[model samples]
Target: MAFRLARNRALIAPAKSALGAIPRTALFYSTSSKPASSGQPQASEAETHFGFQTVKESLKAGKVAEVFSSVASSYDVMNDAMSFGIHRLWKDHFVRSLNPGRKSGGSPMAILDVAGGTGDIAFRMLDHADKINGDRETTVICADINADMLKEGEKRAQQQGYISTNRISFRVENAETLDSIPDNSVDLYTISFGIRNVTRIPMALKAAHRVLKPGGVFACLEFSKVSPAPLDAIYQQYSFSIIPLMGQLIAGDRDSYQYLVESIKKFPTQQEFAVMIKEAGFMNVGKGYEELTFGVASIWKGVKPLDSK
Candidate 1:
């Protein structure tokens, strides 16, 4: 099945040239076998499109890792410049909604912040947990496929005094196959600004469901479809044109940032994503939208059923 998908992708490539040149990395998956490893696990067969190119279901993480590694040193600066610091607020809102309770109550909140480059979400979550729980232990694991990003995250965490003797840890792992995380362990699972890069979003969603405990909360912060037509038009213009230019100027990588914007537009809408969440064995899935001018970002929440055993 996976081989057929790869062949089909090759056949359709000429038709989708409108989408842009096929990434060289896309050709890495042309054969049924895995690509030469960067020491990561083998990829699965359930592949999805990364822009116009069809990559292996499993190789997407390695590609995403390369992108982050190239950009990691300048990632935070680029993020602030590109979003005008709005990304922080989006993350803040996501943490507040998690409602880390007082620690004296019981077991510390266990959170897996997937694709959480540079430990942004994990840092904020730990801060919230400490404030609310009063020295209660909150475990936040910052997981990403990019070693460079994980290293940067660790550096930032250390510089900011966010890492304690035992509060936060970093791992290089892929979201689509979170086999490293034990089932029914985490109280909350989060992926911010990262899912759009995933080639198999549904598989990632299913993995989230698998790792989370029953009653665990799943939250995501991602770029979403905008509202109000006038603002939408302006937002699209900025995303497609301005954002990549900013990336080039700030990060010295125009094409990567261009790919980033295209990937966001290719992502599912807030409504469609909610349905995917439900289909992944989550319940009561809901989404909250934040509109900045015509551009929109969203936080999606869902609960893993206690009865899902």
Candidate 2:
């Protein structure tokens, strides 16, 4: 099935001119959730941009929730198609960087995997945490804004039976704000492929910084700009064209897939994103790229200082 998808992707390359316009269908998809009233404090208008031509700031959570709702059942398949199976490797790298128990002397590690749809990162983290801590417990709260995604993740986790109901928990929460979790509690906070969909990324960074314990780590994995002229061009073609068609063929949801492509283009580059992390009060911010200069994705690491004021 994967081989067939790859061949089909190769045959349907997009033209350079086609990339200039965002699809109207994607930008105007009807959302089931309404934005909170404007009376509530809102992120500054100047800080916003279209996730896919939809006004992005106040409505970002609802719009993003809609996108995931439309594609939740097929989300994993779309991920494999879009990344050509490289997302697994990228996630593995993110986990290995944590070195889960090397310096902690087998103490239990608590992780907050924000926007961890379908438990992909959470499951892996649990496995590695066990290896590192032996009998010590590992707690992961997989939080996401979309309930459908969270339900799906919960179902998958139950099926694996690797996580007892107590060890891994799911919460419906926004990435931009996590009001329920206590400050200075989480040892590591990680969000994979979900930060770009956030309404206020800076606020999300601040929330992450606030949640982590002193000396805790924050890591993110998301789509990034590709490098070197030729591969970059090819990647652009593949993302904007073949990916949406795959969605239509496999998931029956082309518009959501198109939004996925547009959102990636709208995301900050690695350096700019690192700067955002620094602005959130994290220290020693660093970024690592994968898949050669293609820059298909990146893992960013930052530390919340033990002495942060």
Candidate 3:
């Protein structure tokens, strides 16, 4: 079946079809509730992972929505407690690395920050463009599926004096579809610590490719596999032991935080995800990713091919 799909790949856009065309049975590991081996899963019975738990693919979005909504107000606080404020450094580095906005010979940027509901990445992008490059026209649309999260972000933007400046806007959007974003309109597409919660990552990648203008860049920063056997061991212990405790103490939502940690474990390794980026028709540099904080998180980037229409 995999071979057949590979042979027919020319007939379909690889990013759009990769996850949808493959049977869920072929894609994920099953628990004891595995379907019988002889037949395809009923459409309604198709399954995917929600953190470490198996769930109907259709329900994953709602579950994720609940998690984010529950954490919206305390999101920033939990981030500080859980990672000891290191996530801020990672984010700052991520934005500086991109150096968004008008470049040496480029025009002001139109950046779409998917799942950046709390405006962390969006605010940084605007600051980088305005403060670093003197590119005041660079604007960002911060999109997320959860309204409560967007509300928190909007409130923060208002307080930060961005709402009046028209440099950043928030929208309710699904990462997989981006229904309101126009085709070929974005100069850059970014998602930070957000893609793992998506129900269908390949579909999100396809949407990103669709919205980005040819030559536009796609950048993602997400929790990722740590390295060196010893460091991984220590990191795993800290994640499973300390994060949920911090969540309970700070946000009173231990389960959501636990799920978040598990989702990180379930995400693809850096190399595996880089291949997905390439398969989505984006051009990548060799290896295609860089690890930060000893691989606690990583950044991956790709560029839409100039020849793409």
Off by over 4 Å in 2: 1-47, 54-56, 101-106, 132-136, 162-165, 285-293
Per-model TM values vs. the true structure = 0.81, 0.82, 0.85
Q: Give per-residue CA lDDT, model 2, range 63-147, as digits (tens).
A: 6778899999999988887777877776766676665532343345667888888999988887776775453356677888788
Which ten contiguous residues of candidate 2 have the minimum total lDDT? 6-15
Candidate with maximal TM-score? 3
The better candidate by TM-score, 1 or 3, is: 3
Report the Cα lDDT for residue 279, model 3. 97
Each candidate's clash count: 3, 0, 0
Q: Write the per-residue lDDT of candidate 1 for residues 240-261, one digit (tens) a residue.
A: 8898898889899987788788
| Candidate 1 local lDDT, residue 54 | 74
Q: Scored by Cα lDDT, where does model 3 land?
A: 0.79
